[model samples]
Target: MTGETIGSDSADDNDDTLAAAGEFAVIDRLVAGRTQADAVTLGPGDDAAVVTAADGRTVVSTDMLVQDRHFRLDWSTPHDIGRKAIAQNAADIEAMGGRPTAFVVAFGAPSDTSVSVAASVTDGLWDEARQLGASIAGGDLVSAPLWVISVTVLGDLGGREPVRRSGARAGDTVAVAGELGRSAAGYALLHRGIEGQAGFSELRQRHLTPQPPYGQGACAADAGATAMTDVSDGLLADLGHIATASGVGIDVDRRLLDGDRQAVAEAAAAVGADPWEWVLGGGEDHALAATFPGALPPGWRAVGRVLDGPPTVLVDGGAWAGNAGWQSFD
Candidate 1:
């Protein structure tokens, strides 16, 4: 039984599971009344979606989130999971200094899952995609043992050169847009089962859904950013990529990140963990980090400076002796 309300014409299937409601009915509920972006000349119901790349170049990236690996149903709703999936994938496109134009999603879940739940997830995807002025051009659904969400994003560079990770120079300034460490802090609170705190609720919510700094990628590119990347990995780990690719050293001043540490200080105290670790070593925040040749743009904050040396990332001129970031294997 579905036992969930989706506010669709198929509301009668609220108590019906995916197996009972059938695939086409569920898909109709998911795509009904959704408007496509101008870039999407052809959307769902077509054999293939046609997206416009006015610059004659398309930036593409894909990501997959498995149940209990990237998220947990007990802690996140289907809608939250959907938004998280789209947001994370869009960040990759942003990292290349492009704007997302279209997305195609594939979802796998058990047949016993409620149709309403699946519809909610689709709604979440559309909600987030709408924020980027993009559309869910097309997708597929299938039965599986657990919920697996895979999303592929297509973006346009708008005639600008794609900013790569290897372009950072010795004298460039390392800057960042958007907050950090909230996701890790939220995870810590949830893992410890801590609750009813004043501000911790926001942190917990952050773990479920990240708020990436949209539009900042194109802004950074317009400002002549030398190198750019999103903080899907920890700050140190992501910066390490730029350092390695550019063959330059990077030193981050801990003091510059005091605001982030302060934002999670209370949660850290309650959990007996170092906020610095979360601020520096945490991932999934999806913040934009980049290197600029001169003054950073208005929304960007100066965090460090690229150095002339062997490729490495240092915090306060020393190697950070904490968990650097997330790893798929270990």
Candidate 2:
């Protein structure tokens, strides 16, 4: 896409090709001069970049978004897809109670695709990176049958120990920060073609670009959080990760989440869907959910408490009966 003019003479247009310019040149153009956060020690251009953890430990995670499986060209522009991809990946690092520092993206699409669209996607990636004081340190591009985006993010512990799912003691309180069920609500709004619904715009936008509680991950880590994870696999299923990992039980009080339920209630009614499903069964919200030993950090709201039972997540002291969570094969 580079070196070609808007209506450059045919000679110039014909001269540009992936094979001629090479992958390195394209990647250089994409990554050159971008800034990395303080947390990154070795960013891009290496086998794997090293991220500094205050406690000398790192938190890393990866996510892949396949065309139509995670997004649609009709519903989301390439830019939205790119931002969503990074946001989700960053959320994974945050789930461990760490601050996102850098991202590496691998992009695949048809060769005939406009270089401009690819640039647009990179623009979106950088846009989101700017929000977190992070950088797109490296990336890969190749020809594929459809658009496939994979992102891996590295995070810093900020001197605090990494928060794992296995640390929640029985008495730790469960809490969350950031909006829940909005992405689920947005998906419903889009699928049902519901229009002009009050406060639905934010929900719809959430599906396009999730608002991950950007800096809260570090806050959770600093606040003596026993365990933490982002809400990407629905509230209960994500909690299940902590439960299974820690060999402990979690009980979520439904009453504490009524505010979230109320927030999405109107959109649920418009589509004849259960608000609780959107709230409890929803994923992709990227909200921070953690277990704390005492008062929650400034921004978190208490939702429940850790229990002594077997590894499981319960709502209102019981199992939830709706959809469990999302899986690639399902």
Candidate 3:
């Protein structure tokens, strides 16, 4: 925490809510003593913050998280929510083969929320941003019936052409970086109310804070990735996007995915669910999956290959018959 008083000049600093302390006072507490990344020329306090785009090309993406819909306050602390917000947005830049440099966040909560709670969320956002050598440049705070966080990320592509979903081609290798299905396994464990095992505990924690493969996006670009995307929506669903966009088919070898299935097999049995479903259909892992010509990159593992046939995803050369991925309205 920043350890800054809510209203240092007022006697109610220790007990003030956002309403009691007022907007400016609470904002001061949230931004107090936080350091900005080198790319952020001017941060929080003016009409808007200035950020450097040294590559002359900036990649930007935004996402919003709603209370009880995207996250449950009882299950996720303000800190976890904040980290999650930053991670997901950063992953978008990474998928484009760019490096994140700055972020802008907007937060909304009830007026009765404690100033300390807001500070805790700020701390989480900063903690996650620091991991990528980025900064929270600016943001807005407002009153709402429940918590809502919206984040916009700024990235630099280092003069490299962006990796896009439409670039995959037949004869290219489909590979992935970082863990798969772990977050879904953790969500299952949490949803089923199972706890106690050390392994299970770790999985549960991953569901709250995903560990996306940072810096690997630029690595994939440098290694000549033809197409890339983060596994936010299940592997099959996400790869299907690439397939459709590239007008090609993707055939995933089940044997290649045994590791991910094995990782969650025990949890699946405990929850009375199929491990393959989590491996093939679970989303929110935020891992990077890409198609590359020639050899794979250092951090990527071959999972499948692009095909000359129809625009669809097939597992073990056939269609999968389970939940393909997550849909907002489903």
Q: After superposition, how far is residue 35 of candidate 3 from its true place, in Å?
A: 1.0
Query: Per-residue lDDT for 124-229 in model 2, tens only?
Result: 9989987888878777899777788999887776666678888988988999989889999999898878885568987898998999988888888888898998
C-alpha RMSD values across all candidates: 2.8, 4.3, 4.0
Q: How well is each residue in 28-136 modelled by candidate 3, as lDDT tens digits?
A: 8899999899999999999999999997879999999988778777678778989999999999999999999999999988887778778878999999999999999
lDDT of predicted model 2: 0.82
Give per-residue CA lDDT, model 1, range 220-307, as digits (tens). Answer: 9999999999999899999999999999999999999999999999999999999998999899999999999988888999999999
Best by TM-score: 1
Which regions of candidate 1 deviate over 4 angstroms? 1-13
Score residue 211 of candidate 2 by CA lDDT.
90
The list of candidate 2 runs beyond 4 A from truth reads 1-25, 32-57
lDDT: the better of candidates 1 and 3: 1
| N/CA/C clash count, model 1 | 1
Arranged by lDDT, best first: 1, 3, 2
Instruction: Name the best candidate (by lDDT).
Output: 1
Each model's lDDT: 0.92, 0.82, 0.90
